[model samples]
Target: MSSLTVAYAVAFYVAAAVLVLGLVVKIKQYATTPSPLKIPTMPAPRTRLGVVLRILREVIYFESLFKSNKWIWICAVLFHAGLWLVLARHLRYFIEPVWFWVVLVQPFGIYAGFAMIAGLVALWARRIVVNRVRYISGPSDHLMLALLVGIGFSGMMLRFVERTDIIAVKAFFLGLLRFDLQPLPAEMPLLVHLGLVITLMIVFPFSKLLHVPGVFFSPSRAQVDDAREKRHLAPWAAKLDAERDSAAAE
Candidate 1:
């Protein structure tokens, strides 16, 4: 394998490690941090089952966003939906015997690439075009959008413009899985797309992208509205109460 291929392979392994370890650490923190109150958002779910359903709605449909801003929600839907299809299609490169569903998705994933970029462009424009949004938007927000757009655009270019040997691409990824390095196609579009993807993966845990997992752990969304029916207490608070009772008895 060329030094470039070897370097890319190492980079991919390191990026994957960072992404996975970072997510695990962040998730553990989210799990252990105590929620000290019964502060569910008003008009929240009254039961555990209801809370689960509500969270599902929020994740799948962006319920709150849809209610607040239809245009932003539309862009989010297009991006998320297209990105999922594209990811599913990418299974072909990793899997030895590609699944039937992945095969079926190949054609659609090509078109979904466009939708992903279109949504990204609209979202980036919103950050720049809207006064309130632009006021609140930080540099990192724009950078993340640019990274995603570059990924999508370069990927489309690989498909339509500078065609590379996709068979070699698949071999490279498969070899990585098998602990054997393979020659990667050193094409410009492929390099740019992959570099951006690696960067995204490395930064994802520390970035706004944490919202993907963080949403599930949010207090207002995860908590059931049962404060009226039952008293709510955090673990630490409950422990303090128990210690107080023991001391009073002694």
Candidate 2:
């Protein structure tokens, strides 16, 4: 393998390792953290099953976001929905004999890229134009949006303007999975798209993009409104109570 191929292969391997391990550590932290109070949002579910259903709706439909702001919800849903389709379509690259469902959605994924870009652009504009949002926005926020926009644009260019050897691209990714390196296409657009993707992966666990997993860990969404029915005590708090009772008995 050429040095360029080796470099890209190493880069991808390192990025994947960081992304996976970083997320695992963060998720473990989230799981172990204690919430000592029942602080679910108003109109929250009461039962565990209800909480599960509510979380599902929140994840799949962005129900809370929809209720909070229609325009933001629209843009977010469009981008996320498009991203889902695009990612599913990409499964073709990793596996031999692409799944039937992937083949079915292949065409839609192409157009979904446009929706993703449009939504991202609108969201970035909102951060700039809306004074309230702009006040809270930081450099990282703008940079993340810029990175996604760059990724989308470069990917679109590859599809429409200057097509690269997609077959080689698939081979490269499949090779990565099989522990056999393959030559990656040297197209500028493909390189830019890949670099941005790797950057996104590296920063994802630490950045606001952690909202992907953070949503599930959020007390407001994950907790049930059961303070009235039962005592809500964290493990540490419960242990303290037990110690207090033992001391009183002594």
Candidate 3:
């Protein structure tokens, strides 16, 4: 294996370790029995119609995304859109190419590539300019953005200006899809492209990218927020409370 490949493998493993360990530690910390913090709750909107509207607002608008800073929201939305499109385009590699979709993919792929790079640059600029984002931003956060931007930029380069050997790239990917490691492409540029792609995949499940699923797992978003007024505690919580009451009475 080339030194570049070895370096990518090492970085991927390290990033994976940090992600897994960090998540485990966070889960364990949250699991330990402790009294909940008594932070004052915000005054919920009044009236039946208004409360429903408020809940809809939070779910659809991603209110939390913008609470921190304007640029952060922009970068986040653009990055997400770009990443989605890029992934969508990759479906061509896995599936037999249909002419219509293949033709459609190029335009959107270019747009997504530009958007991803632009968003990353804007985010990095915000990190440098905004006091709070800069203060709170860790090295890993910066590294993640840089890596994403690099991947998009390199991909766009290969697609448009300096067309790499498409045949070789296709074969390499098809081999991967088939659970085989085809011999590395003869061209160093192709190897570099594959290197970045593999690096991103290996790091994906570990990083904040994991938050793609974490968002759904979140209690605040996934759980019903109207529970205080609309519904009782889960049967489990209720049954535990009843057992405690019975024990006390005895």
Tens digits of lDDT, candidate 1, 88-170: 98899999899999999999998898999999999999999999999999989999999999999999999899998999999
Which is better, 1 or 2, measured by lDDT?
Answer: 1
Q: Which candidate do you rate higher for TM-score, 1 or 3?
A: 1
Q: What is the C-alpha RMSD of each candidate to the true structure, in Å?
A: 1.6, 1.4, 5.9
2 against 3, candidate with superior TM-score: 2
- Among all candidates shown, the one with the greatest lDDT: 1
**Please, what is the whole-model Cα lDDT of each candidate in the order they appear?**
0.93, 0.92, 0.64
- lDDT winner, 1 or 3: 1
Tens-digit lDDT string for candidate 3 (1-250): 4564345445545655665676666555544423232121345443446555555555455577678667677886777678777877766765556456666875787798788788888988888898987998899999887877777777777787778766655655565556554444455555566567666666766577766545533444433334455544544467788999999999
lDDT of 2 at 222: 93
- Give me the displacement of residue 6 in model 3, in angstroms: 13
Model 1 gets an lDDT of 0.93
Give a tens-digit lDDT track for model 2, residues 10-97: 9899999999999999999999999988889878888999999999999999998998999999999889998998888889999998
Backbone clashes under 3 angstroms, per model: 0, 0, 0
